[model samples]
Target: MGAPVIGAALELLRSPRATAALTTTGAGLVAIAFTLQQVIGWPGYLAALIVLTLLLVASLIARRDEIDWHWAILPISLLAYLGWAGLSLLWSEYQRVTLISFSYLVLVTFVGVFIGLSRDTIQVIRSFGDVLRAVLLVSLVLEVLSGIIFDAPLAVLNIHGELAEGGPISGLVSTRNQLGLLAAIAVVTFAIEWRTRSVTRYVAIPSLALAAGTIAFTRSPVVGMVTVVLLLAGAALYGIRRLPEERRQFAQYAILAALALFAVLAWVFRAPIIALFNATGELEFRLKLWQRVLDFVPVHWLEGWGWIGIWNSASPPYSGLTPTGGRPHDSALNAVVDLWLQVGAVGVFLFLAVVGLAFVRSWLLAGRRRSVVHTWPALVLVALITVSVAESSILTEFGWLLFVICAVKASAELSWRSALSPRPERPEPLPHE
Candidate 1:
C-alpha cells in the first residue's frame, strides 16, 4: 500500500496540477500532525515523520538543477556551533536542551527544502494554509462537540499553571501557547487567501474564527496574534500596491472587507477575549524568569557552562535548574538565554548571526528586480522568519516544512528567471524562412 502511494506521488509530481495539490497538502500536514498531537500520541508523530522523509526524498528527486548552496550552508554553520558547544559541556542542562533543539530544527530544515521546490510562493503559502486549516477545523469541531458532550456552555482548560478542576478546555490539543501560535499563522494565511478568492479559505474561515475564539478562551495568544495581524495588514498593503491599477482597487476592497469581518468577530466575542486577559495571570512570573537569565549571562560570559551544566544549577531567585520552571517561553529569547545558560556569550552571538545572515541573504535576493520567480517567494520567506521570533516554531514540523518550501521555491525562482529572460536574437533563420 505504501509503495503504491509512493509511486502515485511520483507520477503526480510529474504534472503541475497534481504537484500543486500535493505540495499544498504536504506542506499542511506539518500543522495537522502538531494539532493532533493531543489525540494521536507517538504513532501520529511517527507517521508525520515518515511523511516528512518521503517528501524530502521526493524533493531531492525533483531537483531541477543542483540544490541551493545557501540552504546547506546555513544549517551547517549553525550545526557546527551547536556541536562545538555540546561537546564542550558548557552548561549541562543547556546542552541537553540544545540536542532537542537541534533535532527539531533539523526536521524543519528538511521540510523547508520541500517547500523551496514548490512552483511558486503562492503554492507554498496555500499548502501551509491547507495544513493549518485542517488542524484548526478538526480542533474546532471537537471543541464544539466537547462542549456539547460534557453539557457545559463554558468549558475551561488549564494552561501553564495549576489546573482548575472542570475548566474550559481552551481547544488546545496540548499546550496553551501552541494553539495561540498556530492560530496566529492561520490568521495570516486566512487573510491572504480570503482576499484572493480561494474557496478553501472560506471553509477555513470558521476555523480561523474559532482559533481566535480559542485564543481568547486560553488567553495566551494575544502577543503573537497581534504581531501576526499587524504584519499581515502591512503585507496586504504592500501587495495591493504591487498589483495593476484595475486589480488594485478590488484588492483594497477585499482587504478592507476581511479586516472588518475580523473586527466584528472580535467585537462579538469580546467576553472570551476579556476572560483570556484575566486568565493570563501575572507578568511577574516571566519577568522574574527573564531577570534570572540576564544574571546567568554575566556569570557565564564566555563559552558558557555547557548544555548539561545548565540543568545542574539554578539562577538564584527563580530556581532555573528545572526546565519546567520559569522556562523562557519566547523562542528567540530562549535561544539567547539558552546560549548564556549553557554555552556563553559567543554561542549566543553565533546563533543570532546564523539566523540574521539567513534573513539578510533572503532579503537581498527578494529585492532584486527579477520576475515572479525570486521576488515573491523571498517576500513570503521574510514573513515566515518574522513569525519565528516569538513562536518556538523553529523546532516544529511546520518550521521544517517552511524551510524546505523556501529553499526549493527560491531555487525555482532563480531557475524560472533564467528560463524567462529574453535571449539574444537568432538573425539568419528569420530571413531564410
Candidate 2:
C-alpha cells in the first residue's frame, strides 16, 4: 500500500475511540455470530470472525511499543495448549475438520490476547459491560417477539427454542439453558459495573432488572442455582477482605474448609437434590453418557482422537455408533469430558493448569486491590469454571473468548516486568469516567 493509505490506516488504528469501538464491536460480534449464522447462513458468522480478528490485529500493531512482550512468556500455558490442539492434526481422523476448527480457534485466541495486550482490566470490563448490555437487551426484545408477540419460535440449525413449561423463553440463541446462562452472566457483569460505579445507577439498575427478568423467564434451574451460589461467594469475598491483614489468611482457610464440607454434603445428598429439581431422569441419561466416555478413554489414553475433529458425527467413535460409545453425541455436556475425549488425558491436565492458574492469579489480584473493577476478572473465571460443569462453556464460542481474555490478562499481571515495575497503586474509588 502507498504511504498515504498506510498512514491513514495507522492513524485509525491508533485512535483511542477506535480502540474502544473495536473492543466493543468484536465482543458483540462473537456473541451474536452463531445466532446470525442460524438466521442468514454460515457466511455472516465467518465474516464477523474475520473482521473481528483483523481489527484486533491492527489495533495490536498500533500499540506494539506499549505492551510488555517479555512478560508474554507467562501465558505460555495457553499457547502450549493451543499448539497441542493444532498438533493433533497429524493423527486426526479428518485433517480438514481439525484444520478448520483449529484455525478458527487460533484466530479467536489471538483476538483475545490482543484485547488484553491493548487494554487493562478495567477497560476490558467497561467494553464487555457495554457489549453485554446491548446483548441482554436484544435478547429480551427477541424473546418478546417470538414467545409473547408472535408466539412462534425461530428454529434454525436444528435448534428448537421457544416457550417451555411455565412460559419460559429462549430468545435469540433458541435454547432456554443457553439464554439462562447468558442472562446470568449479564447480571454478574452489570452487578460489577454498578459496584465499581463505571456506569450510572439509573442505567445499571434497570439493566440488571431486565437480566434478572430474563433469567426468570428462561427458568433454567441449574442456572438459577449457580447464580445464587455465585452471588453468595462474591459477598463472602467482600467479607473476607474486611478482616485485618494478619487474620485474612486464617479466614480464607476457614472459608475453604467450610466450602469443602458443604461440597461433600451436597455430593452425598445429590440424589435427593436431583429429585427435588425433577432432574433425576436427566441425571441418569448423563450418567450413562459419562460411563461410555470413561470406557473409551483407554483407546486413546494419551494423545486423544483429535482436538477438534472428533466432535463431528463423521468422525470414528461418533460416526453411527462405530464402537467408542454410541451415536447421537452432541457435546460431552461437560468441558472436561470434551477435552479429554478430543485431546486426551494430558490435554485435560494442561487445560486445567492454564485456566486454574489464571483464576488463582486473578483472585489474588482482586484480594489485594479489593476494587470492584479488579474483582471482575476473577469472577469471570469463576463463572467460566462453574458453567463448564454442565456445558462446554469454556471450550467454544463466547465462553472460550472470555476465558482467553481473563487468562491472558491475569498472566500479564503476574509477569516479571509487572512485579519489578508495578502499576501505580490504584486511587481510592478509582475514576471510571
Candidate 3:
C-alpha cells in the first residue's frame, strides 16, 4: 500500500497540469528573487530553492520513461560554456565561493532545463505570461498602496513608492533598472499573448497597460533603450515573416546592414543621445567603474580571478575593487565585462557563442515559422542582450534561467544531433487551462 501510494504520488507530480504549475511557480519565484530575499531573508530563500529543486528532480524521475531522452542533447556551445565555468573551480582563487556560486548556477539551470524539456514552445510562453501577469498586478497594487494610500516607503521590500512623484518606482524588484527590465520583458510577453490569442483582449489589454505603466514609472534609461530596440526588432521580424522565402534571406542581410549602420551612427552621437535620455550621470559613473574593473583584467586576462556569479564585497580582489564610500557593487554592472572578470577572455568567447548561437537560431526560426509564438524567444533574447550592455543580470538568477530556456528550446528545434538521429514524434502540447 505504501509503495503504491508513493508511485501514485510521483505519477500525479508528473502530470501535465502539475508540471505547468510547478514551472510557473518556479519562474515567479526566480523572477521576484530580490523581493523574496528582502521579505523572507536568505535562509527562507535557500529553503524555497531546495524545495523547488527537490520537486523538479522528482518530476523528472517520474517522467523519465516518457521523455524522448534525445531531447536532453544540449548545444555544444552551451555545454562548452558550462564546462568552462565548472573547470574554473580547479584554479579559482576563491574555490569555496566558486563552488557555492557554481552550485547555485547549476540549480537554476536545472529548473530551466526541466521546463524546456517538459513543455512545448507555446506552453513555455503561456507559463511566463501567466506568472508575469500576476507579478505585474501585484507590483502595481503595492505601488499604489505605498505611493498613494500611505505615501510611505515599503522599506522592507525596498519599494520607494514613488508613483505619486511620477517616476522611479522600484516595485518589488528592488531597483528601478531591474523593475524596468521586468516590465519591458512583460511588455513583450503580453504583446505575444495578445497576438497568439492565448488571452482574451480583456485580459491582454490591461496586462499591456500595466507593463507599460510600470516601465514608465521606473524611469530607467536602460529599459528605455531596451524598449526602443524591442520595437525595432519586432518591426524587423514582422517584415521578415511576411517576406517570401527567397526574399527573406536578402531582407535579413539588409536588416543586418542597417543595424550595423545604426550602431555606428549611435556611437558617433552617443554623447547627445545619452544627454537626451538624462543618463549622463549614470554613464559617467559606469565609465569610471568599468575602467577600474578593466585595470584588473590583465592580471588574469586568460582564466579570470574565479567565477563568483555575484560579486562578494567581502572577498579578496573584489574587496579591493569596491567604490570609495559607496555600497559594494553586487555585479560588474556589465555582462560581458562580468564574464571577462569572473571567467576570463576564453569564458567571454564561450559565453558569446552560447547566446550568439541561440539568438541566431531563434531569429531564423521566428522568420521561418508560421506561428507568432516563435518570435518570443528571439524578442526575449533581444531584450536580454540589450540590457546586458549596462547590467550584469544575464549572468545569474532570472536572466540565466531565461537564457537557458531559450537556448534549450532553440537547440531542441535545430540541434545537429536531432538532425542526425531518428527523431521521435513530439507529444501534443497540453491544452491551456
lDDT per residue for candidate 3 within 1-433, as digits (tens), equals 9999999989999799999999998898898888898889877987898899999999989999977777766779988998899999998989999998898888888889888888888888889998888877888889899999999989888777788988688777777788888888889888887877788999999999999988998887888889999999999999999999989878876776787698799889988976776544777677777888998899999999889998887777888777668533688789988899889999999999999889888888788777787888999999999999888988898889899999998898777676678686555443342
Ranking by lDDT: 3, 2, 1
Score residue 126 of candidate 2 by CA lDDT.
83
- Candidate 1: Cα lDDT at 340: 62
lDDT of 2 by residue, 1-433 (tens): 6998988987888888888888887777777756777876767777777877887787778767756675554487887888889998898766788888898788777777777767767778788888777877877776666666676655563222354444467666545666677777788788888877888999999989988888887767667776877787788778767878777777766766776698799779988876776553545665566677767678887888787722566766656333355323456767888788788978898999898678777766666665667677777777778777666767976788898988887877665456766675434346464
Among all windows of 10 consecutive residues in model 2, the one with the lowest summed lDDT is 157-166
> Could you estimate the TM-score for every candidate?
0.61, 0.89, 0.93
Candidate 1 per-residue lDDT over residues 45-77, each given as its tens digit: 657766666765775575534444333222444
Q: Distance from true position, residue 69, model 1, in Å? A: 8.4
lDDT-best of 1 and 2: 2
Q: What is the lDDT of residue 84 in candidate 1?
A: 58
- How displaced is residue 432 in candidate 1, in Å? 39
Whole-model lDDT values for every prediction: 0.51, 0.73, 0.85
Q: Which candidate tops TM-score? A: 3
Model 2: runs farther than 4 Å from truth?
Answer: 70-74, 157-165, 253-280, 321-329, 415-429
